[model samples]
Target: MNVQMADAEITVHTAASIDRIAPEIHGHFAEHLGRCIYGGIWHADSADGDGFREDTVSLLEDLELPVLRWPGGCFADDYHWEDGVGPQDERPRRRNLFWAQGPEELPEESNSFGSDEFLELCERIGTEPYLAANVGSGSPQEAANWVEYCNYDGDTELADRRRENGREDPYGVKYWGLGNENWGCGGQMSPEQYAREYRRYATYVGTQANLMFDHDLELIACGFEGHEWNRRFLEEINEAPWGAEFPLDHLTLHHYYGRGTNVAEADEDKYDRMLAEALEMERHIERMAGAINAVATTRDIGVIIDEWGTWHPEATADNGLEQEGTVFDALSAAAVLNIFNDNSDVVTMTNIAQTVNVLQCLVETDEDDAWARPTYRVFDLYAPHKGNEAVRTSVDTPTRDVVDGDSNDELPLVNASASVGDDGTYVTVTNLDCRSAQTVDVSLEGTDLNEDDIRGEILFAEQEPDYAVTKHNADEFTADDLAVPADGSSIEVELPPSTVAAISVE
Candidate 1:
């Protein structure tokens, strides 16, 4: 196979800082769907006999995940917090409502891993918990009580229940989502209908901030990808007596691509198309931000891509939503994370769907052990960008035309984003071309670099675009030292096709 060498230039403007990239921007999501919660995070008959899987927990702990949204994608809308609380034996075995779970692949939830178990898991991993309250089939009082149960320090029935459940002190969960996908699986409500429901739920859940806990809680509302719907939703929300003072702090939407292209049957053309779809995340963010600006100008509402990643055809609900974690998926993740870093001003936090053993999961698990996937390597590579000041970058890169049906899309062969932190400036570049390498020249606008001040790491350079990770070969996907030759202010980086590289300058 002949490899084509493309050329590109990335100019990093270190002085033009966008905003402090919230560490929570690198957050993750884990729902009851598939094995994400059951065999992935918690095992019933493990060698340790503690229910929580140490192998999985260790990997998550190492990642130092900032925030984890729990109990849902669609599951949270119908989920009643009471059913999953109290004694394990007495806890009712309810239907999973949306997804098949556990090793059995059954539609029922054992309630073995409920609120307390989840909060405990969050504590064990030192990650903040972001709980999505029920709205579709639940009541406002139920939502309020769930908050009281988790965060209230006072002596109340809900607080007593928490004490009885073995947690004497409050969990102090900071982020709370009002619902999940309320336009579809949540309730199929119109923008006005969901907005009314959101206001009602926020009235109860939001009041607890003043009436109960000393700390404040952030209320998140579900927004749609359709900008018109989001505009209408915000318009309805502002109609409340409090207007923009409504308790909403964040607006969220889910983005998942690659549903049409299966990795098993993918070629270079398919990879290009999929990569193009992944880059569409930028448009979604801008549109949502526009909607917020249009209707709720006074409110400080940030954008959150709560559920975003590759949802391939292979990862169906029947098979626990498991799919091959491929290099292509990880490359797309690199591109998306770069977008998050660049848009850190509005993109406060984004949770890839999900954390483990499911669609675009960072880690995969078997009975014996859990291993990091290619996507996990991408997250590990981009970890330095968390809490950093995002700087602007201009990339003049080659493009390839990906013709899908009647539409023609231009896919940039090279893409990059840079950030400035206390350690120094970090720049991540992705070679989106699946069949060619790209030689990229990186230049910092005002700073000159020496060889000693630059360090580079590259991932998936030795693997093909379609390469999928497995338990035995998972270790092979770890990053390797890349040769970044620095001359004056410019650094030359040779990135292999379908690879992600990170360059740090002191």
Candidate 2:
């Protein structure tokens, strides 16, 4: 179907303003599942010397991730921050009941990675820390103590404990999560029940700011997508005895593309399905924004896609939730990022599921060596769009109807979004078809803009068929893949099947 494509035109109205794209929208999630915490991001007395793997930090730094959500997808609720602090040997090793994907007790959580470790990791990679508190299995006092320990500079017991841990200055964590999925694994509570829990936690976990020291903390409540999660959460939250001015700053939602929510089981039509699902992200943003606006007491409350990206395959036996990245995955990522750019107004921050070795991970490591997957490459290409003003792009292209199993979906073979900044204009295009190469004509508008005045790079398979577009395993990867080459002009570009191209005017 892609092979039959001829030409397409993308007109970017640079004069039109589409809001500033927050770098946080390209954020990552690091869960305690699998190697994400253990082998992938942390190790003792190694390369970085502070326990984190050297190559892991180096690769993550390359992603330019603006925010990193720490600790637990489902594991956050069961987490007791107290168990992770103080001495490493003294930290308790608790049974992780979430990674087994059920009520069955399985796997052990080494509380080696705590608040200090998480904050330190964020500092090394220059990403803001978004800590999710334990609201399910832990008490309000425990959550409150963590806030004080991380943000308070006062001579309190918690602050003193933090000082004794060898870090004198506060971590000053601003983005705080009240809880994770309360409707599901977090608690399996009714929406009303979770809202009640949120109030209790937010009451104690106030901004953690004091007169002597001030920190502007943005609190996010665990929200849901699909179902009535958002409506029920927002509706009941206001009913919350709040005990103070509503502390909720944002609502959280999670999405994964596929029927079973596992990527390894994705069929041949996975790419087409992902493209269709990615397109639906725009509608999801709009609907969520509408719901948020309707019930929000504050004008600043927005939606954060805190946990997203594809989670394919059953977890590996020893590793659990580990996934390999693919070229199709890259295109899917491009489509999703473009949607985030389009809805830059309200969809402020998004973290791609688990950042390492887990679902949709950017980097997979074997012992000391780390490999940057195709998904990682996608983020690198989009780094320019961060904090840039979104430029409206109209793409006129042919459509293809993909019959994915029992579902029928229609989507454009070509998708694009553009942004303008002090540096220049950035236009990223994604082609869903994998059989044919496509040529697209792009124009940059606005008084200060000129698209053709810059250079471009393409990731077409035809140009480098031997290059590894994705890696199924560590041994199967090829490192010398084609960099987005600077051979072409900005106005004209070629896209091969399942390709993502970046055009820059710098």
Candidate 3:
């Protein structure tokens, strides 16, 4: 299963589609699941004098994340907004039955990190706050109040209570998710039932322009699993004026990788199966988005893959909730990013499953130390591509039948996406073969850039023949960790199988 090098030429017509390209490809997500909130990003202990972590803040700022989703995966439905606000002393500590060990064993949640804290964190990081409301276990009044509490500035009962809590000014948060996975954890309801409930919530919430705050509200309707959900949601919304008038800005979808009882034991064959599943999910989204557009002819809606990442069944072990990111995780991430870039027109936003602890997190922390996982490295390498529109390019490589007994029999030898920034053009390539390196002849025919303007960097595991997810301590990486190529033209490069490489053309 090697990528055989050939001189087959593929042309990329950049000039023809340059005007169609968009610059806003960067987006992120944060959920209140596991340690993603309590210990992952909002650690009270890690806060400096300003009550914010310098390290976490610095990392988020570097990524320049455009938007972030919060306060739920499944936790949102069971979550009561009042539980995470007001006086910390008055807030009751409830048992987190989601991922915690036991009711009494769970840490005390003082309600200190409520809507205000999240908005403050988003403000500090210069990112938009995408809040998910509770619909499964909550009422429409609760949903409306949650919205008002964050966006209202008037002297209403909720607004007055918010002012009394300490903050008088409104956060003006815009993006509001109706609920998390309504088809599953959020609440296993039929599409018809969810749509009826969605209309009920939307009618009371009002439009984004009518909010008490300055910003506009963008309501997100949770579509069902696959295209059927998307079709059903649009049909129901189109039929009702309340649903159509509620400022439905985006439709949301969620997908994860791996499905075995143990992810660590998921061999290469299983990994390929996961990749195939992800590809199918991506295609399904595209089809579903098209179906929505067909019905909602007048409205402009986008797809938000708010929840996505590699999920191993063994994520929360007795040792801890965090799963160590490995080379396979990096490869999977690279593939996911490629899907996002390729489907930028429809998929507007995406966030890896859990930022720190649950799934493929960028930064994993312990009691005393923190380290960058392979997935984090992939993110760092691809960070520059955020905000840059993807350039349509052609890839030519031999496809092999490597699935063995798995579902997908064939996998491309090379997977890549190119983005042209203000100062340079960047191309990211991944070799999917788990056994051999790949030699790709990438031609920049559409642009007038010369060979001297191009440079390259690679991120392959130091260990040979094994794609185990490993963590790199702070000191393990340096400037040389990014393998930027020397000044050369038409040079032969070896990309380790199951590795990611980034090349820049200045």
Model 3, global lDDT = 0.67
TM-score of 3: 0.88
Q: Where in model 2 is the C-alpha error above 4 Å? A: 1-6, 44-49, 100-106, 210-212, 240-245, 259-268, 314-319, 404-406, 447-452, 460-490
Which of candidates 1 and 3 is the stronger one according to TM-score? 1
**Candidate 1 positional error at 339, Å:** 0.4
lDDT of 3 at 421: 67
What does candidate 2's lDDT look like per residue over 287-309, in tens digits? 78888878775657878999887
lDDT of each: 0.91, 0.75, 0.67
- Give the range of the ten consecutive residues with the poorest summed lDDT in model 2: 478-487
Q: Cα lDDT for residue 226, model 2? A: 63
* Model 3 residue 357 lDDT score: 57
Question: What is candidate 1's TM-score against the reference?
Answer: 0.97
Best by lDDT: 1
What is the C-alpha lDDT profile of model 3 across 167-263, one tens digit per residue?
A: 8888887778898888888788877778888888877775535645666678887875567877876777777753354347788887776655244
By summed lDDT, the worst window of 10 consecutive residues in model 3 runs over 16-25
Clashes of each: 0, 7, 4
